[model samples]
Target chain A: MTDIQININNKTYPTATQPSIANLKLSLNSNEFICLVGPSGCGKTTLLNIIAGLDNDYDGEILVGQQHTHPKIGYIFQNPRLLPWRTVRENIELVLGEHQSPDVIDALLEVMQLTQAQQVYPERLSLGMSRRVSIIRAFAIDPEVLLMDEPFVSLDAPTARQVRELLVKLWQQRPHTVLFVTHDLREAIALADRLIFLSASPMQAVSEIIVPIARSDRGNELAIESFRQQLLQNHPEIKQLL
Target chain B: MINLKRFLSTLSLLVFLGIWQGVAVYLNSNTLPTPEAVAKVFWLGCVSGQLPFHLGVTLLRLVVSFSVAMLLGCAIGIVLGRNKKLDAFFDNWLVIFLNIPALVTIILCYVWFGLVESAAILAVVINKLPNVIVTIREGTRALDQDLLDMARCYHFGKRKTLIHVIWPQLHPFVMGATRSGLALIWKIILVVELLGRSNGMGYQLHLFFQLFDVASILAYTVAFVAVIQLIELLILKPLDKKALRWRR
Candidate 1:
């Protein structure tokens, strides 16, 4: 487990004259779940893209530390982007290659209740199933820093909860830095160890607050609702921004 | 289900043969031979190995031209599809080539390169290349960016990404090109051979036509059509089934 430091000097989308991300500095402790909650179109995904090394146009440098020079990254986009032609198992095995044993896939599939669906192509899988397959794909890599950008947005509540539980289980099984992005504040409170609220205009982290509830109690709807109401009441600024 | 499909296919072919037989009988002329006469000629040609030889020659030409066109078209198409400026510049060139008549290309190739085997193959390849490039270009343009991002994030590298991600997405387009390539090339090869080549199915058919040997021409036509059907059954169909089993 290693802390990751991200320093974004600036980022200006070519189409837009003004910078979307400007001088945003963020630090993530090792083995911590950090949720980046923000308004819609706040460039949260772009920040994740920069961190995952997908977008090179951003003026930023992520320091993954000296001990581990080449840290592995796993990303889950807003949509389930599994290859339509690859089966669930093959999609997971794509990340493994010659690096890890096939047993990890088997174990993860078994845990995620996707063992039966492993041989099925992505098209045959329902939306919920496809989302689960993608989640398995991300965790199967055993990534050093997993960046998820609103993976649970379109899913129904029960399915989303199931997926969230599975994600938490996977995170508990491994020690890695997770940077989850979402627009929903309750979801952030339930999943994130520390919540980082992002402002829409300048697109930078505005405030950081620790989740007061324990991991076990996150499943309680009343507890989560009460916490959400109290946080919004205490900080009227965060409420409007959210 | 497979057995039923095969049965229906056999029935349709039988009905076709019956219709041809009826038509030829009604005509009762040297220009339209009966099925029995054509079948006898076909049998004799096969026993003597003349039909097989000409067929082998034409098949070799088709294979060569098809391979070259597909390879070059896929490469060029991928390049143009990825680069917008290059695609825009070459866009009109593709349209021009696509619109040019096959007869003109064949005649031009023979005139410029002389009546040689290479010229015949080049003429066929040039005729077929643009269609392949266009189909594959559309596929390349339609490639899912999200899947590509997934591949990049997973560190699949260039080779793995191509095989697993890019290739599968392009499979339909490649197959479309191949099937159409086979159909279009076989027909164009006949024209090319008729125009220039000394030996091939087309050359033999030309000889039969000049002699007014309707039975022999029909015999050779039957043999040619049978071979193409065999290729579809033995090679293309199985390949298609295997490659697209993942698709709904």
Candidate 2:
């Protein structure tokens, strides 16, 4: 099993008045889906950046597997950052380069329901369609680890639900470690195998909840509500966030 | 609709010429020749081949100087925009070059290089380079860092990042530099040619001036302006439309 270890001693910006993250430690097992729940501005994105190796200002060490080499990371930002000049298909193909086959891209376009829009540029796409393209881009890389920073935050309920279900299906097809950051407690409960809750600014993990239910069973509305209620009872502070 | 636009443009040009002809007739001075006289002289020069040869020389100088300035300026501007320390160090130098008058630079180059062709092109480049650098530097500074982060996360190599991520963003700025550079450099080259080298449109204009031939001077001016407009319409406009087709 691939084990990932994260040890963040502290991270602060030169202009900031306080550290963004302090003494934050976590680990992940192979193919485990973890959700990080935190209040807004709790440095969740910062933590993701650190893990993605996008930010090196932090005092931390992220050890992925035994060799400590970084795993191939797929990141989906809140807004789809597709290149405006590139068509939807090209944007996905950009990350895969020559390694991806034509059939794989065709399959992905079909699965994402973007077959008709494959040739369209990003500017012509609707918000939901654009985000799907972004998701397609992230998955096209076949990343060993996926980091999603509130991928469904601003989306309408129906679109968000669609994307969430699509994400689950893709993950099941090819299981990989996923660290999803979202403030939506219900969404966290529904998707994550384990949920890590962080306190406000200068974030540190305050609680961890392991969902005993299987992924398929967790989709039921009753089960998700019961899990949310149980979580609020155990960690009352999380109730305020919800 | 396109035909309407073409018709309106031609009508506007006709009106401008009519007004110019009216004023020239009223003045009845050799200095302000009528449009017809200038056109006649222009046709004669075209037939004699002097006008085309001199225009070619001036066009060559313009192309060479413009390419050199743009290449060097874009490289320097991007580096300055990316590096804060370097930008700070060179900020004063940029200001100094920008403030130096175009005439002063032209005269200084001619004097130092002894009226050579290189000196003439160098003078034009010096006049145009600072403006290109400033425009491109601002574009580089305004680049979206979020997109850059996305590129990095995707593991796009340096080459891909430059071509796909960076170049598209910088293109508008490059176009801005090119248009303004062409406008300014052509004018400076004329002055350089008038002051120094002897084979360009500017040198011919100086000859016309000595002979008090207002018709020949006006003919040269019209011919050069037409050539510049043709280059803009045929080359630059199409490139701009194609490169920025995504904006539509």
Candidate 3:
């Protein structure tokens, strides 16, 4: 069965003169990692918001899973939206709820290397540390689908690389359907099973390129570079975004 | 730095007292009593237990009225701030209440309630309630919609959302309301007591006014002001520190 199905016929912002997105349709298999690449302000975040049910102002429907129930959605926003008043542990626990086991929380904290920082408040954390906490928060619920909106956009290169590697490792441990959004083609090539390219504003999928290499193999710099070259050669318009 | 701050504060108070003494000596009138005379009366009041008794009565009225105003004001403010329909409906009403003089409200309550204790307390509450509502409503309106969206995405139910997400963001506003409420309510209580009730610092002040006893009046004012300052230092300051510790 399809893990998720999204069919947004149209979405328009009241302030904008034009519809932001229309005729946007896609389906994903369970555990598939799909990266959406688009120019800035192309309604990629809007699409993600629609799928996550954070927005419902659009036309058409988004159905998750065979039963069409509201699937457990974990969203990692561009900025770590951690409550400044809450400690890192409390922020994670907020999502985990009372029923989740302490062991599960401990494991997530350990994996994120946040065990020591758990007691500290978000304001005390550096940007990278806060982002890691946000990732840990997303994973704590063991969600069926994870939606990330430019989760590493503003980080320093080294920190971004490390976080991406950590994200891949975490995903491998217990795979879930991921809809990762980024403007970075190389990052998309490295993480996604399929790269979905979106048009400029009022976005819809222009094309989709399935990465032939394995997720583990895509991490190799030379391999991803070659893939990036091939993608630019075939779809020259994508180079404009870089 | 801390020592310097303390020294400067003490120095300023001494300077103020010195000026007062100099003025009293120059005036040489019973109406403007000397600092020594006021101090003597203050000591006598403390010894006679009358000062503490009236001060306690005033403090009780302040507490009851302030609590009621804060609780109800916060609830109403949040509701109005969150709902456009309700806010529009009551926006004019809030303005009307806010503009209505505190003295008018106190007098009306006394007349309507026939000089009862509840009337005094209610008068203070009514006087203070609008300010609390205004402050909290502004806070509620300024709440981060992004955080609220995050809460909704996580499926935090109403109770969890209120406690964990909503309340923390609203803490500063609540504190703002509380501080202002304390300042405003205490003054209103004094007025209410003076106008109606035969007890509390206000009543004592009224009696002193009839006898033209400036020294006792100044003593009562000093004692009450000291207690209010003590409450601020002992209770509000510590709570403000703890609540905003994350800011550090």
lDDT of 3 by residue, B31-121 (tens): 9999999999999999999999999999998888888999999999888889999999999999999999999998898888889999888
Ranking by TM-score: 2, 3, 1
TM-score on alpha carbons, each prediction = 0.93, 0.97, 0.97
- The CA lDDT of each predicted structure is 0.88, 0.89, 0.88
The DockQ scores of all candidates, in the order shown, are 0.82, 0.82, 0.80
Error of 2 at A181 (Å): 0.4
Candidate 1, CAPRI quality class derived from DockQ? high
Clashing pairs in 2: none
Chain B TM-score for each model?
0.96, 0.97, 0.97
By summed lDDT, which 10 consecutive residues of candidate 3 chain A come out lowest? A62-71
Per-residue CA lDDT of model 2 for A1-242, tens digit only, reads 54888889999999999899999999888899999998888889989998888998988788877666667899989888999998888888888867567677887788888999999989999888888888888888888788999999888999989888888887888788899999999999889999999987689988888988787786698989997888788789776554
For residues A104-155, could you state the per-residue lDDT of candidate 1 as single tens digits? Answer: 8888888788999999999999888888788788887788888889998888
True contacts kept of 1: 0.91
Q: Which of 1 and 2 is ahead in TM-score? A: 2
- The segments of candidate 3 whose C-alpha lies over 4 angstroms from its true place after superposition are A236-242
